[model samples]
Target: MGIDELREWQAFDSVNPIGNYRTDLNFAVLAQQIARWSGHCTEIPSLKDLLVIDPLPLTNEQRAIETAKADAARSQAYTQSLIATLQSRVKRK
Candidate 1:
């Protein structure tokens, strides 16, 4: 595919090839354009335009998962500290 075809593919703003219906076809089209761009494309699009350097905001589900992981880590640390205190008291007795 050429630059003209690539531009044509990118013309639609709401045409995300991910997280939508028609999974197989969407991925195939996205892959084809990316391969063409990477293989022999001069003057690539900027990072801002691609939204790679500055990523999209996380959804509520993602934020909840991160919070749960952090909570589990803190709980494990507190449990370990309590066990160490109990062992030290037994030794003293």
Candidate 2:
């Protein structure tokens, strides 16, 4: 009963507008609802999904920079592990 009533209310509100007809919030909601209705889609893509799109293929220079960053990170991790092992050995002595 609740879901049915909510759907009916949404149907009515879609045409009527929920608040001051020309207000920004009302327009934004109306626009989103219209997009969903027109697209025959129930779920809107999340803001993160919309904004954080897959990056374009990297140029060779960009790929090299990324590779360098990854290599530096691995080297740092290895150094930290070595230092930890040495510290443990020193503590035992």
Candidate 3:
């Protein structure tokens, strides 16, 4: 069941005044099991589906900004790797 349905079930369970019984324990167990299974129930869209859903047509300025950000990230990663390599060489010496 979805999160909403699970919440509804929980609400009903909270107000249920049948006293502490085996059925309550059973329901709790069932709710736990359902919670575990809920992760699998979520629908993750594929790449093709995402493209169709949100065809992000960025403007030239926006594209330029994104490209600059990516370039900065690449440069940062390269600098980090170089630092790591130098540190390893020092350790080996």
Candidate 4:
């Protein structure tokens, strides 16, 4: 009964944005529901199906640059997430 009501309510809500969608609802859960309703898909890939092979050789300087780039990218990704978190905090108030 609960799921049926949720589905019916959501059908109307999708057309006209009417409810309070709280942050208590997880993003992953929202994404899954959206994907299902929109007829798209979210896939979890298996490790055996994935293959990454790097055949190119690099010099010492080039290797250092690549390593630095990877580290910088990791830092940048975290910084972006931090900024988004701060922005969301500002929005909620």
| Pairs that collide, model 4 | none
Expressed as tens digits, the lDDT of each residue in 1-93 for candidate 2 is 799999999999988757543464445556666767798767874333333223256789998999899999999999999999999999999
List runs of model 3 lying over 4 Å from the truth. 1-54
lDDT tens digits, residue span 1-93, model 3:
999998998898788634455455555556556656778636543443323223377899998999999999999999999999999999999
- Give per-residue CA lDDT, model 4, range 2-93, as digits (tens): 99999998998888556333332344455556656776556643322232322366899999999999999999999999999999999999
Question: lDDT by residue for model 1 over 24-65, one digit each (tens)?
Answer: 445555755785678776655443344332344668999799
- After superposition of all CA atoms, the RMSD between model 1 and the true structure is 14.2
True-structure lDDT of candidate 2: 0.72
> How high is the CA lDDT of each candidate model?
0.68, 0.72, 0.70, 0.67
User: Candidate 2 has which clashing residue pairs, if any?
Assistant: none
**TM-score for each model:** 0.40, 0.41, 0.43, 0.40
Model 2: per-residue Cα lDDT at residue 58: 79
| Whole-model lDDT, model 4 | 0.67
Poorest 10 consecutive residues of model 3 by lDDT?
A: 45-54
Error of 3 at 61 (Å): 0.5
